[model samples]
Target: MLYSMSFPLSHNDKNKYRYSHHNGDSTCKGIDVHEIFMTKSRVRLLLSHIGILVCLVNCYISLVKDKLCSSSIWKITVIILFAKFMQYKPVKKESLVILPEFGLQLETHYWSGKIARRFVPGGKILRPVLNECVTPFTCYWSLALILHGEDQLMLVFQELKPPLKLLVPIWKALRSSFDVKEGSSA
Candidate 1:
């Protein structure tokens, strides 16, 4: 009998070493969309979320630590907004591609006409679509914060949460009235 050990590295130890070596600059740049799409485990999803949370933390840190002036901060925020919007665009397209590919992959792998029966909605579809639809409002809220300062920003941010709930309706009404009044006067 022969025993073979691969890499002589325990999984936990390898993970620890990998993480310790990353200095926050190691982003999700190299992650394969197909791998994420194929992963059905909640733990993997949670880990992905954790990575995004880390990036958000880094963004907050840079915003604070740079001690940027108000105007410069606003500009930086706009740039970040654009980057986020663009990042989601490719994801959205990939998601659209995946829906049809999923059917094909399932058909080829299972060799059954019942393959479609096993289909479940995937995050690849939901996340990108939701993000695309929400991007404008997201940009709006962030820009509002940059323009109006933290106190007002908090109020607006809370309103923009979801489904246009909370203060958004009232805010929009006020904005429309304000615009109407301006047009009438002009």
Candidate 2:
């Protein structure tokens, strides 16, 4: 059986994000898996590229029309670089594959078709925790793992930060898979 849930994007967001849970099957050799996909809109991508092009064109026009000095040229270059940096998102998806008797697999899928995975054995999983992170501008929640030997907690989702509502189910599933009781360490 498969279970899925999608959260509507806020007014300011252009991309759609959702996460799904897939039950494991012995016959197919599939393990219980939960995946969060970051879907990019083609129109949005096109528009962003167009905006960057327009910025470059305007910069060129300014140089020709105003005979800008080196300082102004440097300013234009900085703006273009900042714009490119802000628009770059390489992660396509992130997943948590549950291996019942073994451990959990954390997978990160990149836009360039690269898959990076990390495995944490069941014995090493001290517990699953939900953390509320506060920033000066915004607040967010994150799911993390407390490994037996690791001093620092490992974040479940590295690139794509899913909201608290989407993270709860995964946190519970992880707890259950590791046979951990509420408010108790493994």
Candidate 3:
């Protein structure tokens, strides 16, 4: 069976966020796929295009009006800053594919149609952890893997940090797959 759900990232966010789970079938035995997608906002995409167009027009006018004047240099610098600010995120979605009898596959999909994937064998995965990451200005929840013989935790969703509400179900599913006992962090 395939289960899918979607909601806003936040009250003020205009972007659509969704996740889906696909249960394994006979073709791919014992495989479970969990995916989270972030759709780009049309308004934001339009604004970014307009901003880039305006920046290019201004840059050409400034360069033509004064070849090497200080004013032209300043104008170019401002245009570059604006272009950087208007840049859109490259990642489109991320997925976790669990093969209970084999291992886990982490997949990242980019807006440029590129997919980056990594695999970890079932034996190498010590545990699935839910971490509270604290930054100077804010805090967020993250899902990670405690791998055998590895010092650093492997983050499941590298580019997109979905909320705890989204991470809990995945965490539970992972724990169940690994047969992890509750109240034990061994």
Candidate 4:
């Protein structure tokens, strides 16, 4: 896939600009002045290039060792590219938290090591439909104790309960903790 970007001609200019494209004729669009603001950085551009290379390598490896079909290879490549370059993050874990007190706390985690914590003060847990993961890849989902900052984090969700309306945003943020860091696997 080819990527292109547009930039304003200058601070004083608005409509006139130029676009750079990897392949094909790049055309600049004339939108209202400052309709949307976009900024690019060298690090992000470099990472995008690296992401493409990784996708290619992964596709080749899957094709060689796994003997995956060409279509599957393409699918995997697309997934990797979309994941890495397009900044689409995979949901790592979702959970309902049970605090020590009578109330409860909800937590969400991402592979990027960012934790989303939601606290419901004095929120009583009537009952917990606790589902435990006995082994790795159980139910195609495994539970492993991994150290997260100061806490040992669980990779699987054990409790079943939807957070309250106020906590929904917190859950959403926790689910989206995919903010890629300098050296994250996400």
- Highest lDDT among the candidates is held by which one? 3
Worst 10 residues of 3 by lDDT: 6-15
Q: For residues 1-186, what per-residue lDDT tens digits would candidate 1 score against the true structure?
A: 111212333544333111001111245322111200121335645665665565566567767877676765775676566545433111110111123223101111111222222222222221111111246444322112111122222121211222222123323332342233433421
User: Model 3 over residues 47-105: C-alpha lDDT tens digits?
Assistant: 88899999999999998879859989999999999999997777899999998988899
Sort by TM-score, best first: what order? 3, 2, 4, 1
TM-score of each: 0.20, 0.78, 0.79, 0.24
Task: Write the number of the candidate with greater TM-score, choosing between 1 and 2.
Answer: 2
The CA lDDT at 84 in model 2 is 83
Error of 2 at 102 (Å): 2.1
lDDT of 3 at 110: 96
Global lDDT of model 3: 0.88
Every candidate's lDDT: 0.29, 0.83, 0.88, 0.39
Q: What does the lDDT read for residue 148 in candidate 2?
A: 93
Say which candidate scores most in TM-score: 3
How much does each candidate deviate from the true structure in C-alpha RMSD?
23.6, 3.4, 3.0, 20.2
Q: Which residue pairs in model 4 clash with each other?
A: none
Q: Which model, 2 or 3, shows the larger lDDT?
A: 3
Q: Which stretches of candidate 3 lie over 4 Å from their true place?
A: 6-10, 13-15, 55-82
* Candidate 4 lDDT score at position 110: 59
Q: Cα lDDT of model 4 overall? A: 0.39
